[model samples]
Target: MFQGMPLAGAQAGGGIVSLIVPLVLMVAIFYFLMIRPQNKKQKQRNAMLNQLKKGDKIVTIGGLHGTIAEITDDVVVLRVNDVTKLTFDRNAISSAVSRETAVE
Candidate 1:
């Protein structure tokens, strides 16, 4: 038996709580700093996907630029050139061209 030792139950419970508080704080920090922004971006991306329409000029994730010729539930037909049409997933479109691009 060790003399001058702290009570077993109290010491063990306090030590566990001390360890858990930092872990909980870390999870909260990660949620705010990392997870929250990622979810926001995903929501924006989903909104963009839902708003796809014909005649919308868009840039794909692959950097291809084209105007939407047709839109399906999950596929987009892009008219890249007079004879160069391409099909891509709705998610593959990164963003629509702004009004600045339409003027030119």
Candidate 2:
């Protein structure tokens, strides 16, 4: 038999709650510092993809630049040159460049 030992581990000052508070704060800090901005950027990218239309200039993930000649539910026809047209998935378009931005 153990003689005169603290009956519970919680006898340590600021037991479970003190241990848990810092962990919760760390998770919250990570959410704000890392996760939130990533989610916001992804939302902006999704919004841009949805707003794509014919005649919009886009850059593909592969770094190829083209003008959208046609659009469908899942495909885009990009005219890279007078004689070069390529079909790509809508997701392959990385970003769009407006005439104003492209000229600058």
Q: What is the TM-score of each candidate against the true structure?
A: 0.87, 0.85
Clashes of 1: 0
lDDT of all predictions, in order shown? 0.90, 0.93
Residue 46 of model 1, lDDT score: 91
| Candidate 2 collision pairs | none
- Model 1 agreement with the true structure over 1-104: per-residue lDDT tens digits: 87678787868978999999999999999999999999999999898889878989999999999999999998999999889999998889989997576634
* lDDT of model number 2: 0.93
The number of clashing residue pairs in each candidate reads 0, 0
Candidate 2, residues 1-104, lDDT tens digits: the string is: 77767668656566778889999999999999999999999999999999999999999999999999999989999999899999999999999998898742
For candidate 1, the per-residue lDDT at 50 reads 90
